[model samples]
Target: MYAPRSPPPSPTSRQLAIIRFGLARIVPIDDEAPFAEIAAAAGLGEVHVRRLIRHAISQHVFQEPRPGVATHSAAPRLIAEDADLAAWVRWRADDCWIAAYHACEAVARWPGSEEPNETGFAVANPTSLTMFDFLATQPERASRFAAGMRLYAAHSDLDLQYLVKAWSWGELPKGATVVDVGGSHGEAAIALARAYPSLSFVPADVGGRIRYMIHDFFTEQPVHGADVYLYRACFHDWSHRYAVRMLQALIPALKAGARVILNDVVVPGPEEMSPGLAAGVRTGDLGMMILFNAGDSEMAEWARLFEAASSGFHFKGGKGHRAQGCGFWRQSGRDIVHS
Candidate 1:
């Protein structure tokens, strides 16, 4: 009979620091190199490099077959393959980890503050600037953050094809206009345009997109009467108060038959999900709390948000309602009221 093994202990801060140093320095030059050679490449002493490598070996990040040789394992190999993945690791080690360190003090001082600027990130940086503003001043850090987001999108199930396959976009009339709000880089719009040639897309990011309307959801929307308004993974970054305002901004522009589609996680109740699934969402919730005092909403909260936005709005059918959840809300027309 086979015996079950216990899970490995979490890596120590020193271990993580060593991992970051090695990832930034050693991995790029050679996946497998002598300890002395790696030390020379990284401008560190051989003894210290061996110690860090041994600790990393314990975590399966790298391998040491003999006393003097170091080689990349699956984890380090994967990181070496993608520059963005490496940037993500560095960002986590540098930025996110620093913010997390100050989270307790931030919570104690703020005492339920809803402002994003009052976050742990803000507390750690010793600036009145929001994390976004702070990152703007640090271009390299900002570049890493952007690269990390791209890595996240590339690895996660949140790919554009997932949205295209899940939603019934073909149901709409040919030449129907779809407005992608806050559509950074127009990734989703471009993907959808390629898949459904019949549909017209206006991505509200970057210049020179045909008839691109600069609509900020915080204020009133500029593009009115579009067949569909698409908001993908946008709402979870804000508190309910801001989320309500964002939704309300759409009300003025939304014509009778207009559909507002939100592609975001609809967090399930604790009892409704497996422990692993629950942990995944709750982990995201904690990150949101630390970063922006925001959270993933449950289905009831989503329904309430729409109702609070306006009585004329109603929740409608949606595919891909479970994994990487999406929801559809329709604006009620006078003649064909949906209540």
Candidate 2:
């Protein structure tokens, strides 16, 4: 006789409301703006925010005291502490992404451009510089952007901890030097150094960002000594050609036998084939596409890109080299030997 299967757990109303409040950060929500006030601020009827808050309350994403007031609770705590979410919010809510969202409509009208046809938005409203470019002009927004990124970093730290702990680094050769190519503030590098005291980590990024990391984390003096490098999610922002060029820059510093560790999503197989996994992969791909006009890549694609960079350079498998559930590779001749 087969045993009965357990039913899926149901979310509490309070939990759902809290989640809605977090999402509200993406939309517009303010303590000064109650449900009706928020609706007015959004230029909608007062009942709209009320209806939304009621539905969210059912989901437990926010807490509603009495009839229409909504406030923060435990549900939004995760989002509050998340760095990527903060970055996304700052990007999306900024005038640039908002303008781009409006501009997306123009794609159908005009089609030709020397650059990639995918504009952040396609509709014709007002042509302006990029959000980051605009932020450069407005230093205050840039500061806000930095603050948002820090919030996102808090959440990312947990995930980084998991990845670092799961991937063994003790096997790396003594005096192994790591370069975090685009590490924002050396958080990942610090974690790795703490875990493996012998390895040295160097967190690298563009000038301004790197300066911030030096000020914030390295204030107590350099922690990783000189072995490991924590790049975080920098190289993935560029095309494979540029990524290889970035790697080439590090060859002089990279000790022979030192490994490059990339912490990013590896796109999975087709959608109909692996529904759940495909959904996640596709979502990540779309995120990269929308945000940076980039997409998630397959392991084979990564291997090919790495092999193309140098003649003898290939994936050396040991610890911290496994590609999650995917296969591994080694460079041999012009071919990438996968196992």
What's model 2's TM-score?
A: 0.57
Where in model 2 is the C-alpha error above 4 Å? 1-118, 121-131, 138-158, 166-168, 173-175, 204-230, 252-255, 271-273, 317-339
lDDT of 1 by residue, 1-339 (tens): 999987753464544565466543465435568888888887888898878778778877788867888877777777667677777777877788888889899999999888888888899887787777889899988988998898777744566766777667889898888888888778888878878878888864223333455666798888877888888888888988888899888788888878877777677677877766777777778888888878888777777778777898877634344434422111111111122
Cα error, candidate 2, residue 155 (Å): 4.4
So what's the TM-score on candidate 1?
0.83
lDDT of 2: 0.49
Each candidate: RMSD to true structure? 6.1, 10.9
Candidate 1 residue spans exceeding 4 A from truth: 1-20, 23-31, 204-211, 317-339
List, residue by residue over 1-339, the lDDT tens digit for candidate 2: 999988733343323332333445533334423677656555566675676666656666667766666665554544556545544455444533444454345333434321222445322123344334555776765766676656644553235665565455787776566555556557676666667766665553332222223322212223333344444555445556556665555555544444555565454445423565566556545544443445556656777677776755565422222224423111111212221
lDDT of 2 at 145: 66
